[model samples]
Structure formats: C-alpha cells, structure tokens
Target: MFTFEAEFFPDLTKTSVSEFCGEELSVLLHTLRRNGQLIEQLWNLVEQNGAIKLYCIAPEEDALEPRHFNRYGLEALSAVLQKSVRPPVFRVIGKTVGLSDACACENSEYYVLFSNFAAEYSPVSCGDCNLPVPLYKLPGENEDEFYALRQWQGEYKACDSLFVLSGVGEKFGYREISEVDSSLTRDGCDVCREMSQKCNRPFYYFLHRHISPLETCPRCGQEWGLDEKLHGFYAFKCDHCRLLSDSP
Candidate 1:
C-alpha cells in the first residue's frame, strides 16, 4: 500500500531553481516530496526516505490529464522495491495556481518531503527526458503559461528550513548547494500540442504507460510492437477499452 505519514516541504525561492531544467525539475520534485510513500529499506538508510517524486506543471487554472511518460518514475521505483533497493521517496508536484516567483504563493509557505539515497546505493540518473509533457489548457488557457530555465540562488540554501522537524525528518547534510537548472515546463506534452496547433510546448504521455521503444500507445489499443506502430498517438487510458483513451 502507498502511504505518506510525513509533513513539510522545502523553500523554493531561497533555494531557487537551477540553470538546467532537469536539475530544476529534480529540485522541484525534491520539494513536492512532502507527503508520499517511501521504500522500506531506503527508508532505513537515508536521513529521510520514501518514494521518489513525480511532477506536472500547467496553468494553475487547468486540470491535468495523466500520461504514459509519467509511468517511468513509478516503474523505476517498483523495480527498486522488487530488488529491495530501499524505501524510495515520492515527490509529486502539481501546479494548481502559479504566482510570480516563490512569492507567487505569497507569505504562505509550500512544503514537500525530502530523503537521501541508501549508503550502499547508486545515484539513479533520471533518464533522457525527451518526451513532451501535456500542458493543461483548460482554465488558464488565456494566461499563456510561461517557461524559463531557473536555478537556486547562491549563498542562500535555506530550503532545508521547510522540513527540519525533529522526529519527522532530518537534513541530507550534503552541502550548502545552490541553483538547480529547471525547465518552467507548461503543457509540454504531445496531446496538448495537437490541440493547440503546434503553438506550445512538446507533447508527453497522458496517464502514461511504459512502452518499450517496441510497445504501443495503451490508449489506442495499439499493439504497435505486436502488429503496428502507434503513429497517430492518443491521450489517457481505458484498459477495458483495450489500449484506447477517452481524451479530448
């Protein structure tokens, strides 16, 4: 069962975003890791441990449709658990209503769970994030969700203050690190692109399914590897529908 019995998140402004989108996204995932699951073994090794994070960004007003690309995080964790890598952490970040910068949320602080890798573990590199992410254009379609490459600030790594509870958690104690390159990704997924007439970010899997380069788009009931190639992709899933989706 997936359970999160923790409280807290990190400070995004002080720690800020990094220069690269991948690192920034990781840091974002780091903060959103507030209340999620963790693997049992990894849980024992890190100062704080649990499931890894999964994130999706969009106009605060838009509602998100799941994707296939999103499956990797969980699949990787499931593998770790099967191999007993350790209790992993999950940092799921969603943008409901974005403001300008960290103050965008005002004095109201945000939070996420944080954890460390096991002592006998290897750093798992988030693989090639080349797939597109779906932009939620439902509510904030008029706002024009923006994008940028961000990083954490220098000399001010006070992000740890958000989750420094005594028994609840402990700091990773790595370094006064600063800046993590993050992509201000908004509706970068494919399904969103098709609807927007190619005027937006890249497209990604909605309610993602792990398709080997050989697998098919689950929504399309497409057994591309088995018989065809999912040339005309689709959105969400309906296993009952036999690899088809109900996406708009």
Candidate 2:
C-alpha cells in the first residue's frame, strides 16, 4: 500500500500542493468541496477507516498560509485520494494518534503509481496547435501558476508559426517542404514566387530558421533521412511514407 504524510501547514504554497498531488486531483478536490454530500462522505471515511488523519500545529487569525490544511484542503486531499484509484495507507497524525512509520512500499512503487496516473490523466492535445499537451491546472492565484500559464501560452504561440509552415507547401500544390529546403534562400522556384504573391510578402521572410533538417515526415510521422543524388543535390526522404523533398 502507498503511504503519504501531509503536514497541515507545510512551508510550501498551494501551487506546490497541486504539483505534488497533480492537476486532476486538485480539480477534483475543488469540485468536491462545493458539494455537501461528497465532502461529508469523505469526512466519514476519514473518521471511520483511518484513510485520512487531520492535525493542526497552531491556529492563527488574519494570516492565511496556503500550506496549512483547512477544511477545504482536507476535502481536496480526501477527494484526490479517493479518485487516485490506488489503495493508499493514510493516517491523520493528531495529538493522540502518535507518529507512525513511513510507507512500507519501495520508492519505485510510488513512482510507478504516480507515473501511471499522470499518463492516464494528461490531456491528449493542445487547444491551439492540436499537438500533444500535458494536463495542467492552476490551483491557486500564485506566481507558480502565472509562470506555468506563460510557458504554456508561449508554446501555443510557437506552434502557430509551425502550423503555418507545415501547410504552406501543400497550400501551393507543391510537395511538403522539407525543413532543409525551407531554410534555404528563396531566390529560385515557382512555388516561392506563388507563395510570395499569396502572402503579399517574400516567402523567406516568414520561414522559420530554427527548423531542423532532420524532421518527422508530415505524411507518415517517420524520421526523414538524408539521401545523396547523382546530381549532387541533397534530399530528405522517408522510407515508410515514400515522401521525398529535394534541397534547393
């Protein structure tokens, strides 16, 4: 059985709690606190089965320490444990319960459980790019959430450029542009000329320079390999997809 010891007023912030427990758990806790029946059921389980133990260091007025366990915090934690689906050995250490041993299972076992939970709960795709996006949540109004949101938003902004580039060649009835060819100077080619006219700007102006020559094939999602032709020009080809793009 997995064991967890949560201090009522840890030095960590609410954001840290969310990171430790994960976004799904944090959200579930938020949802459960709003419902009377669920919260009562959770407290009953904690009281009856020793599934959760509650303790307080010292109560203070006018200071809201995000780390400390309050009613909402307990409710959130209970909800998370219930939803985690794995059997957990929990004990609320109060003045009476006395200290108990840490979990009996090895650290590796806990790692596997949490890893499986994240994989099953994480989001499949980003909302903007439709690329894979990890499941994430902002649990509190804290700097941590601010930074996480900024990082996530930055990725979506970067994907906008990638999405445009990925569709450019196809939009012009040209073969999917290899990263190598796209990086080359756009001084020649009817495709570039047409693209310039369509965008009302030089095609190379919008091309991303950081694109790697070795890229995944748009058709088959397989790695593109370098191919040398008799004409001395280099090409990128994917054997699985039969997709080929000659270097300019």
Q: Which stretch of 10 consecutive residues in model 1 shows the poorest summed lDDT?
A: 118-127
What are the Cα lDDT values of the candidates? 0.24, 0.30
Total backbone clashes of candidate 2, pairs 3 or more residues apart or in separate chains: 1
Model 2: how far residue 225 lies from native, Å:
6.2
In candidate 1, position 74 carries an lDDT of 44
Question: Candidate 1 — what's its lDDT?
Answer: 0.24
Tens digits of lDDT, candidate 2, 179-220: 324322122223334333433333211122224443565556
Per-residue lDDT over 1-248 for candidate 1, one digit per residue giving the tens place of the 0 to 100 score: 12222222223332322221234333323222211111212221111222223333222221111221133334443433343333433333433242211112211111111112221111111112212112221112322222210011110123233223323322221121111111111211222333234333222222212221324453354543323223233333223322222222
Global local distance difference test of model 2: 0.30
Tell me the lDDT of model 1 at 213. 31
Candidate 1 lDDT at 119 equals 11
